[model samples]
Each structure stands twice: as structure tokens, then as C-alpha cells.
Target: MAMNGETKTKAKSNLSKRGSKALTPFSPYIDAVNQAKSCQWSPSNEEGFFLMATAESVLSFDLVHEKIRTCREVPATVGLYGNFRGGDRLRSAIAKMMERTFMGVEVNSAHICISSGVTAVLDLFFFATCDPGDGCLIPAPYFPAFDNDMSIRNEVQPIPVQPADTHTYIPTAEEMEKAVVEAAKRGVKPRVLLITNPGNPLGTLYPEATLKELLLWAVNRGLHVLSDEIYANSKFGSSPDEFISMEKVAQNAVLENLLSAELVAEFVHTAYGMSKDFGMNGFRVGSLHTRSKDLLNFWQNMGMFAAVSNDTQHALAVMLEDENFVDSYVSENKRRLKKSYELLTTNFKTANLHFMSACAAMFCWLDLRSVLAESTFKAESELWKEILEECHIVLTPGEACHYGEPGFFRVCYASMPPNQLQVACDRLTAFIEKKRRKRKAANIS
Candidate 1:
């Protein structure tokens, strides 16, 4: 389906200037993703593609679906126009769930705004807080789609703060400072610092001490802090008390006089959703919890475009209101996550592949440096292609995640059954062994 020269010219002319720059007509990563979708691995399909690239957990989806099914029927008002900021029933349920589950403090429903998804929540957040060309400082080895989330419409620039040691993933205070200076040089004003708790792809949770320090640092620099806690309830392989919400950290910081209450109210915000924690990505439900009256005012004027459907809101509200079901569901979800993570890591160890041990998110940062032909990003891209095209296993390349180095990839284990995971491991290990043998023969020659 190659386009002729004239056809290509016609297609290019059809697109708007901004649309042409933002859209991709051809991408190897996207091609692999489409292939994975068409041949997804299942029990009957032994030759199917292994989709380990996306951050989706199908482990406890049955529980979530059942809860949604049994929840109260959608209201008649759903047929009519609903509140732009979200219904009181759903927002109140979310506020209470925050207290009962993770936040450890009461949240005011009035301060919460419901949106179609976290993607939209962040889009509106940036629109309200920053002007065009303003930058948000995000750490390297972070979520790749954030480029789309921050930029596609809002025109907010993402300035990556890379760590001194690429393996650490988290950038140091000095590194962040340097990023701000560099952003200024590029004429991008640094307006926000985004922290992904239970780090995406890395799956490492920030310690309470480190969280406090980062919050204080942001406040001192007059940067708004947006903590995306979408995976808050997904922390496994640890005590429940080990997982702390950003709101709790902000409150404690204020109590300790490290941050002013006014500053914390205006600057600190949280984004949460049903996608990761509840295995309800299809629900398309996300919320923004902020104490800023300015943000709420902005939403009042422009929130209708991103509001969640009334029926979907009601169903999720009922699900959250059932405290017993919510409690048991969370416990079982974590157990399944822990089991899947252990299985994946055991296979990695058996294959002599190095990985950073993860406790929260569904992904593991896998190192394939030993199998690379050279220490370059180009080599990394080639390895990714080989694994996908030859081994039939789809993994996200480190380059896509903006990681500072090569030979690393994100492996999502919770997206498949254990049996399929074992098959994937066998294929991957076999590929690695063949590469090693060829390297040995080449060295001897």
C-alpha cells in the first residue's frame, strides 16, 4: 500500500500544518502494536503474538465486571444532560473511597472533577495551569505517551530530567535544577513538576522520605506538583501501609511547616483513575483531585467536553459504595499481581536476564544489554525489532520511554495468562541463546 509520489504530495497537502507535525503516517512501534492486536495469544492459538507492551492488567477484570454488572441501574437523568463537573453521587463515592482505601484523610467532593480519562484530566490540568510553550519537568525513563498527553492540544512542553546514573531512573535534585536551567535556555518556562508514583515502566515506589523532599523542592522553586497516582492501589509485595498517597505527604509537609498551607492548596494536585488499580481501562473514568479554586473555576467553564457519561458514572459509584466488595477486590487484585510478577521475574532469572525488582506497577524494567550487538540506541532498536518480529513477543523499547540508555525494555506481565507468559519466556530465551552462540563463533573466527 505504498503511495505514489503524486499521491503522497496530495495526502501531505490535505493535512493542516499542526496536524502534519503531530501525526505519524508510518511507525515501526505502531506497526508492531497493530500486529500484536491481530494475533493476540490465547489458549487455542499457540502461534499467536505475545502482547507484553501495554500497561494493562487483565488479572482481576472479572471481579470488576461483575461488580459493575450488579451495581444499581442507570438513572433516567442519564438520557438528559448531566452535570459538567460530574454527579454528586459518583464524586462523593470517590471521595469516600479515597479515605477508606488510600488517602488516609477525608477529601471534599466539591474539589474533585471527573473526566473521561486521566489523559483528558491531564489535558485540562495543563490547559488551566500553563500557557502555550510552558514546560513541565518530568523525569527520564518515564511514560512515553506523556508527550501526546501534554502536547497534542495544550502545546505544553515536557522537559526530561535525566538521572546521573541512568539505571536509577529517578533524577536527583541537581539534575532537575539543571533541567530547569536548560529549559530556560530553550525559552520554555518551567511551570510544573510531574511525579508518577509507583513509577511507570520502572514499577518502583517512591519512599515517604523521598516524596516529602521532592514536594518541598517543588514548592521552593514555585512549580506546581502534579502527582499521578493512577496506580495507587496496585502496590503489591509489601505491606498495605507502605503505599502512601501524595495528598498525605502534602498534609504532613504542611503540618511540619515545610510547606505553607496556601501553597499546598494551590500547587499540589493528584490524578487517579479506574484503569490500572481496578483493571477497568475500558471504563474511561479518571478524576482530578485538587484544592485550587482556580482549577475548579476553570473546569466549571470548560469541563463539559471531558465529562464522564452519566450511566458509567452511576455504575462505578455503586461499585465504590459497596465497601465490602471494594475491600475484597483490592486484596485479590494485589495477590494476582504479586503472583504474575514473581512468575515473570523467575523466568528472567532462569534466562540470566537482569531486571529491577518491582513492587507496584505491572511492568518490569528488563535489561538485554548482554545480547546487544553494540552499545547504542540503534542497536537497542534492532534488538526490539528482532524480539518482536522473530520471537513473536511484543515489548516496549527503552527509547520509547525516554530512558537515558540502550538495551532496556519494559515487560508487562499482568497482560497475559501464566501459561502464555511461560511460552513467551521460552521463545525469548531461545533467541538470546542463539545470539550468544553466534557472537561466540564470530569472536573465535
Candidate 2:
């Protein structure tokens, strides 16, 4: 075959074969969804699937029918819309909700920017705060989406802060500081610090003092703070007063003493939404708050790239403005979450399985080293796959959540019914027992 110079170059390029990171391991929950199609596990087809990896509200969509009826009775033109294509009314409503409930410190609506949801807000943050190749400091065992969002789309480096103890699963402030210091030494100079409140995969909330110290350190380092406060409302046994927003801390006089003296107009952006707290994942409404005009303008420009849907904005506006609705929704969500926690705790205790504290959020981080320690599986990811094949139950491997540590998995309690939770736990116990027996037989031989 005749080939031109260009063709030869292309052929050589193809043969060069640059490497890319491996595709994310298949979601076990997705595998469970596929298996549910073949097995008759529950009375109704609707109830059998347990794929709840997203922070979706279990009850958020059920109220939509009622909302539809309510909206019909009101005037069609009653909806709020500002003159601009992407106005600040929706942003104002979200700020009001946060001010009244969690933060209690008032913020101007003009200072907030509305986005599709928390993910959109995060995307905007990366675009605004980070240049390509800039690093973002993220505590390990974070929400996997953050790592994916920063690394894949934004092309920013993730400086991981390793946990002090994999067994206890707590993120230490010293470790976080060390990671940032090391990154700075390596010339990455992390521009932003991302922290998930009420923690995601680990399920450990930071103490007030620890949070304040970290905020001060970031301020001294001239780093912008990105606080993902979507899980703010899920804290158990704490008054709203106990919940402190980093934005609020930056404005506090007492904490300012420990921070930089430059009066640097410390940049702090808070991301809030209804998906996790209100169980309204479909609403797709979330807002980002910041005091920096530069950051605000950056987001405002990015808003042109992707904006929240009109109907979702209206629905979220109604929910945010109504004190009664917010109160009722929050109380009901807490009740449901408490029930889920109780069911999972009881099952874990009874099965003699070890799990981290479920202080808040819908998941329990389980240490599976006991099971993996005896198995022939050389990799924890492979062990996760084996568990799914044997037990027909799904779990998120710890690595997916950015904890490189082996022998840990995240169990979401919010998706499963109490009975199903018990059944899954039982199945897990049986699987572990079988593995133990096989190991014993091998030892005897």
C-alpha cells in the first residue's frame, strides 16, 4: 500500500500509545441494579433495587405531586424572575434559607450565584479559582466526584491528605497541614482547600476547633476555601448553632486573631443544595455564596455556560422561602435518617461487623480487613467484586472515595428498607464466615 509522510506519522503516533488512568472501577451498586433484574428479591419490582450512590433525598420526589397541585391553584405569573437572563432572586432565596437556618449570619442576595446544583457550583469554583495545573488540597476519603471533577475536567492536581489511622478513619489537622506544606514545597502551591462538612465517605464531622484552625491556616497561606456544606443539615444531636459555616468563621473576630493580618478579604465560597437534605435530587437547585467580587464575576460568566432550569428554580424558591415547608422537610428527613442509622447499627452489631460511627449523613464506612485478610484476592477492588458475586449486595469500595487504603467499603443506609438492610447484613456475615472456613481448611491442610 502506498503511504504519504502524513500517513506514516499517524501510524507511528498510533503505535506510540500514550497511557491514561484506568477507567473507574464499575460501581457495585450498578452491578446490583443489573442483578436485581434477574432475581426476585422483593414483593414489588420498584422496591428491590438498592442503587443509591447519589446523595438523593429518599422523599424529595414524592412531594412533587403535591407541589404540582399547589402550583396549579396559584396564578401562573406568580413565579419570581428578575430582568436579567440569570438573575439573583433564586440566589437570594437560597441565601435567606442558609442565613435563617444554619449560618444565622445574613448575606446579601447579590453576593450569591445560582447554579444547577452542588456539582455545578464545584465546576464553577474550579473555573474561577484554579488555573490549569494548579493544585487543590483535598482531604482523603472525600466524595469521589470532587477528585473526578478537579482531575479529569479541570486538569488540576489533587493533593491528598492521608488519614492518620485507617481503622479510626479520622482526618487529622496535622496531616492536612503536612500535605499542604509538602505540596507547597513541591511547587504545586495549592490555590484552594476543599472540605466536605459532616464528611462524606468517612462520616466523621470535624470539631469546631479543628475547623477554625484549618480555616486560619488556609487564610495565612492565601488559599481560597471551598466548603461543601450540602450535608450541613444532616448533623445528629446538634442544635443549628453547633453548625458553623466557614464563611461565618472567616467573619468572626475571635478567629481572625489566629489568621493572617493582611485583611486580605479572605475568599470563602459555600456550596449549598436540596439534594441531600431535602431528598430532592431532581430539583437540581443549588447556590454558591462568596464575598469576592472577582470570584462572583467569574461564576456569573460561568453561569452563562450552564444555568439551573426555570421550573427547578421556581420549585426550589418555594421550598426555600416557606419556613413551614423547610421545617417540616428537615424534621421528616432527620426522622428517616435516624431510623436508617438505627437499623444499620443494630444489624452491624448483631452480625459482629465493624463499622465507623454514623454521626451524620446516610452512610457507614466499614472496615473489611478481617474478611480480605484471609481471602486469595490480592486487591481490595477484586475483593469488592467477589463480595458482590457471592452476596448480591452492593457497596462502594473505599478507593472510589479517594481513600487508597485497602479493606474498607461505604454502605449507604438511606437506600435500603429496614428489612433489606438486615438481609444484606446477614448475607455479608455469611460470606465472611465462608471465607474464614476456607482459610481454616487451607491452614489445616
Q: What TM-score, over all chains together, does every model reach? A: 0.95, 0.84
Give the per-residue lDDT of model 2 (tens digit) for 33-87: 4454355346464234344344444533455446534643333543644322245
Local error of candidate 2 at residue 226 (angstroms):
0.7
lDDT of 1 by residue, 23-135 (tens): 65223475667657787777798667888888888999989888789885977987887778888999999988877888887799998899988989999998988898999
In model 1, where is the ten-residue run with the lowest total lDDT?
1-10
Instruction: List residue ranges in candidate 1 displaced over 4 A.
Output: 1-11, 25-28, 239-241
What C-alpha lDDT does candidate 1 achieve relative to the native structure? 0.85
lDDT of 2: 0.67
CA shift of 348, model 1, Å? 0.4
The TM-score leader among the candidates is 1
Clashing pairs for model 2 are 57-279
Question: In angstroms, how far off is 112's CA in candidate 2?
Answer: 1.4
